[model samples]
Target: MSLPFSPQSSLHQRLRVGLGTMLVPLIMLAGGALISFEGAVGSFEQQDSISRQALFPLAEVEGEILELTSVATHAQPTNTMTLQNYRRKQLVIKSQLALLSDYFQGQPTKFNSVQEIRRQWLEIARLCEQIFEATEPEQLANAKVQLSQRLQGILKNTQELNYRLIAFQNEANFDKARAVREKVRYLVAFISLLALALALLFAFYLSRSITDPLQTLAKGVEKLGQGELHHRITLETQDEFNHLAETFNLMANQLEQSQQDLYRLATLDGLTEVYNRREFNRWLLVEIERSQRGEHPVSLIMVDIDHFKRLNDTYGHQAGDLALCEVAQLLQREVRPGDIVCRYGGEEFGVILPKATSADSWVIAERIRLAIAEKSVVLPSQQHIDMTASLGVATYPDHADCKERLVKQADQALYTAKYQGRNRVHSAEVNECNHQINKLQRMLVKQGT
Candidate 1:
């Protein structure tokens, strides 16, 4: 059985209290009804026993009458013992009649016929007294006829009344027992109905409470996932459910802030707030794949600040950082959309241009070199510092095969540019390793001559 109250001041408490309340009252009522039914049964048994005791004497007297009558008619000759038995049986019949009168004393009308039968039985008793006094034939015959008739009627009435009274008491007790049983059944049904109703009510309340908050929290979590950090679910109650909702809201807000922080971390270079080396590699690979798939020409331009370490040594590390930022911004301004500019390393940067051939890439690299050359930055000493960059250009499937190799070969060309001159645009085709081999061969021939 379930009760309709909450167990504690919590969200799911109704179920606990509902069952407890229903069980307590139902157990008490069931026990009380059982005891009441048992008491009723005891009373019914006691009444039955009293009725049986009252009827037993009548049954015994009727048996004696039958026996005496049989003896008087069947025996060929009457003996003194028979005479004494007849007289004693007549006396017992009168006594049973008196007892029946007393048993039916309250209902005078019900016993009127039996009372007349009792009066006739009294006459029969007087006749038996006469029989005991005389030993004559004519008197015995008349007395016998009168006594048999009266006694027969009286015995029949007494037995009939006893049977009727026993039957009536039995039926009354049975009806009472049945009624009590039905009452018990009804009480049990009522209790069960009450318990069922309470259980449903408690379930409804608990489910409503739990689901409402859960729905709110679910929506809140979803919105927070979609970047709505300011959303919070309301707590309508002062309970653990409310606390959980509050915590969820807090966690959602924290997660949104964390997501923002991660976004910033992902997009910005850790030191320079420009594109990082990973971004440069990603752009180069994307451009290479796009060019190969679409049959478009892609180009990579590698740039390095001139004497960056010497500049860092001349000024402080902070000035070197400012110089890098200024150079990165200048390079970004010089590039177009679909052109990638990233800080390749500490004092190096890279650009990947999609659909650009070697000549176009070389021209863009030269422009970037000239742009950086034109720009000047104020050092920590409040003096203007002028710097230049060396650039190298390489095209897909022309100077290198893969994006990484292309970028590396361009970086080698940039090294060549730095070696050949301090600041300039150099092409992989110009250095082309084979060109140097031919130049060295020409030099060896000249030395041999």
Candidate 2:
């Protein structure tokens, strides 16, 4: 029998545990990744945008300077319209640079670079104003020469800063993004593999828990089906499968008991509680076949209750039944363990001895006769009557070879014993069979009976 299941031992509980074990790590991994990306990666995204934005202002300043230099170089030397355009463009460029300077206040390096560019811009504007005022070719050429020299230093500084900002964005965003993706891959792979392994482990557990018990039960049922009435099952799982195993074993026990009951009903004599006539004939055949091998001879003693018809007429059928039961009990008690006693018919019995000779048969038959004569049966009216039986002994390979001949010879000897005196042992192997009766009587008396 199995113990009852605790909550933890329940099937549903086990399933829940398996699922939780498989999913918990993945869940934690997902949650951790989400939190890390939200805080750290969000910060990186904002920094990446700010770095790209920083370049926009610098690029605008460079474009404005280039446009002003172009207008100055292409202008007619004596044209007032060109000078007006240069003055308006110069004011706009200075205003834009001031905003760019404020944007770089957090970095001293970039702020210093913007301050240098501002100084250079003021120098370039003064030379351009000189070129616009000059009418002589020598004066114009001298002012343009100074403007070109200042533009070279400021343009180089701006382009170099722009290259540095591009390199910073690549380092800050692309490299970190690759590292984050690799970390995610490792986490996902680890969680997926762990969950798969756990799933496989639990699958094996469930299979054994489920299929092992089922196989045991199936084997038990098969044995029972094959008429093995003593087969049983054992299981120790603290779950419904164990309970089912216990139930199946219980059912097998009941089925075995029922089969025994059926066998008793079919093969036992109801009145005498001995084997019935059908079993007697079947066993006789079996014994005869064994004796045919010639190594060990078998014997049979056919017994009939003397004066049974007269007893039934005198008392009642119940008295006759009691006498039969008493005689059967006495025969069973006197016989050896290997001997078989059967109610051959109404008031008649057969004893099969597997390895007994004719002499042994005669002795056992006489003992049975003496035991029957001493036994007393009480009628329903409370009257006691002494009973006696006539037995005929026959041995295989001497009196008969087959079951039919053995039983026929024993029956003939029985008829002869009854005809002679009705309470004597007769043997088919002997002509008189009178010598052993008195000898067995003396032997029984000397046994402290």
In lDDT terms, which candidate is top?
2
Which has the greatest TM-score? 2
**Over the full model, what C-alpha lDDT does candidate 2 score relative to the true structure?**
0.81
Residue 67 lDDT in model 2?
Answer: 78
lDDT (10s digit) by residue, model 2, range 309-407: 999998878888899999999999999998999999999999999999999989999998998898899776778999888999888756764689789
Candidate 2 to truth, TM:
0.67
286-390 per-residue lDDT for model 1 (tens digits): 777777678777888888999999999988798798888898788888987768778888898888888988889888888998999998878767899999999
Candidate 1 local Cα displacement, residue 116, angstroms: 14
CA RMSD of all predictions: 12.4, 10.1
Cα lDDT, all candidates: 0.76, 0.81
